[model samples]
Target chain A: MDTAMLIEKSALVLLLFLISLGVAAYQTYFERKLAAWIQDRVGPDRAGPFGILQPIADGTKMFLKEDFIPAKADKWLFIIGPGISMFTALITSSVIPWGTNLNLFGRDISLQVADFNIGILFVFGVVSIGVYGIMIGGWASNNKYSLYGAIRASSQMISYELAMGISAITIVMLTGSLSLNDIVKSQHGMNWNIFYQPLAFFIFFITSLAELNRAPFDLPECESELIGGYHTEYSSMKLGLYLFSEYTSMFVSSAIMAVMFFGGYNVPGMDAFSGNILAILSIAAFALKIFLIIFVIMWIRWTIPRFRFDQLMHLGWKVLIPVAIVNMLITGLVVAWNQGWM
Target chain B: MSLQMISVILGSLTIASGLMVVLSKHPIRSVIYLVITFFFISAMYILMNAQFLAIVNMIVYAGAIMVLFLFVLMLLNLNKEMEPETTRMSLFTAVIAGGTLFLVMITALRDTFQYGKGYVQVPVQDAGLVEQLGKLLFSKYLVPFEISSILFIAAMVGAVLLAKREKQIID
Candidate 1:
């Protein structure tokens, strides 16, 4: 690659990494505020200007707190666990197309980092590896609650992944290419995948919730029984890393949902604009979609109760998988029919 | 030249981690080593521009299968004290089996080197891309692909059957 391209990519990567971290930090604040609003109580107003500075305060507190490890905890794995969690969480954002191309310095700069041919699969691969974080953390802690939580997490993720992949396959089939940019381009001018494949979108949305370990599917860290679940023995920034990774994954998943089911950055009559204005507006539009999705996710988290472990497993295996497969078959028939395969 | 250097580096790392999988005393550690080996192997695939295969390899082996292996090992809690003593007969059988496998690998390597370049290379351009792979799978290798999918389904059914508990008739 040329020096300019290399520099562009590195800059984009750095920018994306910072954006993910920033979004995650603020997601925690929004989550608390939303939860408080849902429960009819005043949320944090002590921090600067409507508690906008709360995330910073929380972050500083996490850093300054005692970084404790249990006596029986496996030292290296304990450290590696949260690192893996945070790493996997952050890296999945690389493939998502955040906006349209911008023309700068006689060059067209794409807003995506690496537009790999197998972009969606890359996300899937990272997500599958995400389980190791909780598993290793729980196992390393040598605590029963942690182990139980880890086991629950791995099983839940594995079970939901089958349905999730199947649901995503419908979109892949529709797009006829694995590239996220292609998927977004195909949905130009408000022809979102959600309109055509609502069932698939439903399955994908539910499965994403399961994959993110958010309520009402959060059986892994059910506090009433497991007491903070996998991170029960964790403290300080070690705990902070785990929580941060969760919100980061939430951000990434919301982005994926927006890109896939929503029209990504494509608004009706968006073709009217061109160049830098287009790129900036598209980025703003994409960001708006992502925030809306995040709001709905948090709304569900506060509104719905956690599922029973068996109920979660049942929904994943018996309900979601079958529905996804049938939806995929119907989509296949439609695609084939459209292509004169009948 | 740099691609070759990267391939060589990844190849050696894969072998080293593969060796550690067997050499590690702890089962969980062995699984971790196996995952490392898988990562190196997938990196090699990426180096070859086999992006589709690389990610699928990651999703399947390092992601799904190894997670289950780690899960089982963690639950088993098999420490040194819990490890069963290796019998003489078992050791003898293991040695013989390992020796036979080594001989087979040696023969395979010898034949590969004799008939072709010392290193393997994918002959077709963009053969590792999803589009090319999909076309090839549907056209040239359709029967084998179908048969393998069938075999997978059979294996999945067998697993479910094995795991299902028989219903009890309570007196």
Candidate 2:
């Protein structure tokens, strides 16, 4: 790669990193505020206007708190646990096609960091590895509750991942490509995958919720049952990293859902504009969709009660997996028919 | 600086981690090292421009399978005190097995070196791409692929059957 291209990609990477972190930080504030509003109470009103600065305050507290390690904890692994969590969470966004190309300084710059051929697979791989962060943290903590949480997290992620993969395969069949950019491009001009593959979208959405460990599936860190779950023994910035990674993964998964089912950065009448203005508008549209999805996720979190472990397993294995497989078979048949194969 | 240099570095690291996998005293640490070894092997696959292979390796081996391995090991909670005593008989058997495998590999690899074909080239530039791989699998390797898939199904069914039997016994 040329130096200029290298610089451009680095700049884009930095921009995405900042955007994800910023959105995740704000998500914490919004989650609490929404929860309070749902409960008919004012939340964090003491921290700036409408509690806008609450995340900052919480972050500072996390930084200032004692960085505690349990006496029996595996020291190096304990430290590496949260680091891995944050690393995996942030890197999953690398494959996301944020917007169309921007014409800047007489150069066409793609908004994505790396448009790998196996884009969706890359996301799955990162997410699969994401289990390690929780596993290591909980196991290294040497606590019974933490170990239970770790086990639950691993099995849950593994189970739901199968359904998620099958669901995504339906989209892959329809789009005939694994790259997220191509998937988004295929869905241009209101021809979103959700229109054709609603069942796949539903399955994917539910699986993403489970994958993100959001409520109804947040058994790993369920407060009442597991006492903060895998992160029970984590303190200070270590705990903050775990929490921050959750929000980051949430934002990334939301973006993935948007790109896969929704029309990504594609907006109605997008052809009306051209050049950098179009790129900016597309990005804005993508951001708006992502926020809408995130809001829905938060809404579900507040509205639904946590599922029991058996119920969660049943939903993933018995229900989602079979349904997703059937959906994929139907989608494949339809696509094959369209291709004149049957 | 070059791809070769990077590959060399990765190869060495992979070996080191692979060694650690067997050398680590703690079973959990060994599993973690095995994961690290899988990651290095995946990286090597990337160096070979086999992105699909690299990612599948990561997902299946490092991600899913290794996590299960780690889970079982963690559940067992095998510490220093619980480690099995290494008797001379078991040690001798392990050495014999390891040495026999080493000898077989050395003999197997010697033919390629003798033929001066130790360095093989990827026949197609995009051989490892998903499209090319899929086409090849469906066309050329279809029967073997189908057979392996059937084998996998059999394994999965057997596991489920075993679990169900155990549950019935408990009831």
Each model's lDDT comes to 0.93, 0.93
The residue ranges of model 2 lying beyond 4 angstroms of the native Cα positions read B116-123, B167-171
TM-scores of all models? 0.98, 0.98
Local accuracy of candidate 2 as per-residue lDDT tens digits, B39-134 = 999998887788999999999999999999999999999998987899999999999999999999999878768876424343467789999999
What's the interface RMS deviation of candidate 2? Answer: 0.4
Candidate 1, position A247, lDDT:
97
Judged by whole-model lDDT over C-alpha atoms, candidate 2 comes out at: 0.93
* TM-score (2 decimals) of chain A in model 1: 0.99
The regions of model 1 sitting more than 4 angstroms off are B120-122, B168-171
TM-score of chain B in each prediction: 0.91, 0.90
